[model samples]
Target chain A: MPKVEFNVDRCKGCELCAVFCPQKIIKLSEGINKLGYHPATVKEMEKCTGCAICARVCPDCVIKVYK
Target chain B: MKVVFERPRALSDVTTHYCPGCTHGIIHRLVAEVIDELGILERTIGVAPVGCAVLAYNYLECDWQQAAHGRAPAVATGIKRALPDRVVFTYQGDGDLASIGTAEIVHAANRGERITVIYVNNAIYGMTGGQMAPTTLEGQVTATSPRGRDIKQAGHPMRMAEMLATLPGVSYLARVAVNKPANIMKAKKAIKQAFMVQIDDLGFGMVEILSTCPTNWGLQPAKAMEWVDEKMIPYYPLGEFKVPGEVK
Candidate 1:
């Protein structure tokens, strides 16, 4: 299984990861981070393909993936 | 477990000040990744321009010098000439490079200044409230051009990559967009090649990246990227306009 980690504080909540995720497992959390934006989180880790598309699309470089 | 992706060591650890979904962060990461891969982090000197990426020095872990508005190429010239062994580059935006600092970039490229330039073109001036830029496409709506840019009055969109390719001094010139993962990968490769040209002492090199300004464009991050693909790519086709041996 692929593991995804997000540096919540670094996320600006642009949601590019969510938009680009091939698995569509990434989504914005209801709660805001220190910057007051709803940072992205993995909703269904089991479905994540670890393609790292989220990391590639994320402008903030806040996502990391391990396989 | 194998690491698929992580922050490059060439990037600083602090959070960036860019707006949410801003493509500047993506461009910054690509540059940092290239620096790390090339093993030139210690000797690389970046000249930050007077635009949204003015604080690029804060995000990039390398020696940096802040340049006057549109004068990054000039400052980079001086730095490269003085410290010939150092790898120098300039990070500039459309307003800074195409409008205010046009002469500086042209002269530097014409002189074969042996430096790399990362030009970010977002169509509008992001730092100055979305004013129409020289690279702004025809019929594009900006803060200053409420009714869209009029080609008769504003003239045509400036294609810097194609324009710069005409100069014999330039060794490499390419235009790439970060709208999608495949494009981002190609953009990174172009950036790396630009740096490599400078490293080999070929000549002036540049990679013009089509970026997005969602806040200024009044669109969501995803939509802004779509706009880039829909509107921008038609006018500015992405490809290597010039290469060392291919040109001339």
Candidate 2:
């Protein structure tokens, strides 16, 4: 199992991470973040491979993956 | 029990001012990761350019100096010469590095200054509202080039990596991109290598990153990345233009 954390406020809603997630577990949140952008959130935490692909593609450095 | 992916210590906690989908944040993180891995965070000094990354100092957690437009290489040269023991680097954009700062960069590379330059070539100028830069592709429409770039009037786009590689002073030169996971990894490695060149006192090293400007390019973030692959890469070509100890 792996853990992924998101710094919601730092996210700019680019969705690059969500698009790159190999497991397809990340998605934009339904609500807006402080920046008025829908920050990414893990849809199914269990499906996350902790591959850190999301972190790699994120432009905001908002995602942290622990394996 | 381990942090597999986390913010590099060399990066500040504050949020960046880059627009959504801007690759500047990714490049900054890559550079910070390199600095952290090399343990040069304290000894490293970054010179910020006057373009979109002008506030680069705010995001990077290290000693920084703001350089005038297109003068980062000149400022970096002064810093590196004054403090040879310290690792000096410059973060510049196409407008700052390729256009206004072309002479400065060329001379610095020719002189083989022991400094690292991270140049972002997004084709169009970002901060100045999407104007055609020196690296803008032919027939690419920007705010200034509304009808697409007219090559006859604008001339051909500059290939700084290839141009600088021809100089004997440059010990390392590579062009990379952050459009995908694999490319991002390669880009990080190249950045590390560029910094290592300076750490080893090799010579001038530069990594030209083909970045995207979603807001300016008038395309979705993902589409802009694809544009880099379909359009920019064809013209720019990603690979090592030069490296230390390699046969010419």
Candidate 3:
């Protein structure tokens, strides 16, 4: 099982993870959340290899994955 | 193969009170590592800021002083002026340095104070419920800037490293990010260089590290680093902004 989750309210919309990810699976949806920022979305769940590259690059420690 | 990543000898064994995934702990380790490598544990005195790292003295194994909000640089100035032989430094955050202590930093640099400043720029006020800090990017929304940071209303994000580099009294200034391994290595080198500047009895030196504040920025730790790399980097580019002996 692979789980991807974000504390939606905490997204700063920096979009670095999506840019740095080898798979490029992460994307920021135009949809606004409660925090009103364009939070990132895991658009391609199938492509996620759980390498945790996004986790390593994040300064806020907002992403978590379970494999 | 086993690698030990515990606290450095220059740092105490006490666990940091920083939130999980907070980069302050990593920064503390980096500074302590530099202190250990330079063998200035006994003679080093660190002045901590009143932000999230206010209790830094408890974690670092050396002489430490607690300064008021944004006053670490001023306190460090006094300490270094009195004890010219001791290596003195100040650990401050964006809110501390770019905001409240702006005048103190300017004067310190203008006077060519021989001290190192480890400036952590996380964009928002980390410990203070994610307020809009002086380094917060334009259009970036914070608790105080829910409608997004307007350039007209908020002025602009202050780039301390670039600003300080122009000061003639400043001998070294570098801006680095800690969002990944490569950048982290670069950041460590920059920090070491700042310390070495003081060790050589040079004038003011500072290493501004682009850090992340997940809790404040409302992003997962991973996304926060990404933001730092993408948005923050574009505004506050990384690399050595200033150094004495660099061939143009």
Q: What docking class should model 3 receive? A: incorrect
lDDT by residue for model 2 (B57-95), tens = 999999999999889999999999899999999999999
Residue-wise C-alpha lDDT for candidate 1, range B1-248, written one tens digit per residue? 89989999998988888898999999999999999999999999999999999999999999999999999999999999999999999999999999999999999999999999999999999988999999998988998899999999999999999999999999999999999999999999999999999999999999999999999999999999999999999999999999888883
Ranking, TM-score, top scorer first: 1, 2, 3
* Recovery fraction of native interface contacts for candidate 2: 0.78
The residue ranges of model 2 lying beyond 4 angstroms of the native Cα positions read none
C-alpha positional error of residue B192 in candidate 3 after TM-score superposition, expressed in Å:
0.7
Cand. 2 TM to true fold = 0.98
Query: By summed lDDT, which 10 consecutive residues of candidate 3 chain B come out lowest?
Result: B1-10
- TM-score values for chain B across all models: 0.99, 0.98, 0.96
* Regions of candidate 1 where Cα sits further than 4 Å from its true position: none
**How accurately is candidate 2 docked according to DockQ?**
0.83
Chain A TM-scores, candidates in order:
0.95, 0.95, 0.84
Q: What's the true lDDT of residue B136 in model 3?
A: 90
Q: Output the better candidate (1/2) by DockQ.
A: 1
How do the residues B105-182 of candidate 3 rate in per-residue lDDT, one tens digit apiece? 988988889999999999999888999998999999999999989989889999998888888888889999887768
A1-67, model 1: which lDDT tens digit per residue? 8989999988999989989887888889999999888889987798988898899888888988899
